[model samples]
Target: SRSLFVKNLNFRTSDENLKKHFTEKLNEGRVQSAKVKKHLKNGKNVSMGFGFIELDSVETATKVCKDLQGTILDGHALILQHCHAKSDDKVSNRADKDKSSTKLIVRNVAFEATEKDLRQLFSPFGQVKSLRLPMKLGNHRGFAFVEFVTKQEAQNALQQLSSVHLYGRHLVLERAKEGETLEDLRARTAAQFTDEQNGYQNSTKLAKKRKHMDILDKPDVMFEKIAR
Candidate 1:
């Protein structure tokens, strides 16, 4: 295969680590080299969050790209595209990029479940970026947000969890909801603390969305909330 430019590598990663990771992805190639170039101004290393791999031929490279483009590696998307130039940076596509909004909403949880328990359940599907269980002081609300490394994995989790009962109750799983970006997830937690102190609820939409998603208005007890 023609030489490729693998950019966006982890700043702390070395050629050997990249080779091992690529070897796992290709499974047929010997990644000859995986070098991390130094920044020019102060010689500081910057993780461009990308990298390259050399295969025996163009056919192998194409096959590799086809297999791993949307996969997740090292808690980030393993972007595999034809290399154009050398520099470590992210992909130009929005779908391939991870922004502040990609996260999963896990509801109808057992009141006894802990943060560790939630992580253990979903970690098998993919790298969990974060697993947060809503707790007020020492109270468990039976709701959580388990953020997977990729959106596809999050969807997979929802499919597997829907209609499935844990602790004798059907678990509610779906996309966390719009307007609930990753940045504001924790913001609500902080705001909730203040609101609790002042004896009021935060104005964030998640609390209300959670209420609606649980289908609290439905009259039947046997009904399940379906994700759109």
Candidate 2:
């Protein structure tokens, strides 16, 4: 299942040229197919450096990536990866070709449910840390993803929620759409924390200094001003 994308390829390079390059470097007929993307603009075709190469197997793909990534190809380093699609969804919520979120799905709920409600219901089985409740036109769809503190919690919820009933509706919980890992969650949390910290550090220093002065009674009228 290792489909690779080669970036920074020569614009004029054809599938035959690319196949020859791979054959020289790897082995005979290792490449299944290779094609550069062409776009029609003003009735003229333009070649894009990016192209896909299907290898014989995942190991061969890895070998190609490890060997060719960062290697110079026509004045551009060849970047290779497992042909991940460009998506707006964060790494955790990536939508594959199927257009489904990588995160797990949770369904079958009472229309009045909230994230807090789901967490409470699932917390008994394990550490229910975070919950995302989906809404349509400002109405709860009766399903939510309860991210447990650990994968084991998620697995437990997958098993337990099927039998557990809340508000007369049986809860259905599954792994986050794409089986997102703890590292992805941590990275997201770290990014948010960095953003919040940067904003606070940049904008709050003067206000915080004024508040500190007021607390020390340096400006006695500051309290009155704040009260007013």
Which regions in candidate 1 have their CA more than 4 angstroms from the true location? 1-95, 98-101, 183-228
- Against the hidden reference, what TM-scores do the models get? 0.39, 0.37
Error of 1 at 174 (Å): 2.3
| Top lDDT hit | 2
> lDDT by residue for model 1 over 108-210, one digit each (tens)?
7777556875675565445688888767679866667777665555655565445444444566775755567754665554565466646644445667887
Off by over 4 Å in 2: 27-29, 84-228
Question: Candidate 1: worst 10 consecutive residues by lDDT?
Answer: 84-93
**Every candidate's lDDT:** 0.58, 0.60
Q: How many backbone clashes does candidate 1 have?
A: 12
Predicted candidate 1: what Cα RMSD to the true structure?
A: 17.0
Could you tell me which 10 consecutive residues in candidate 2 have the lowest summed lDDT? 92-101
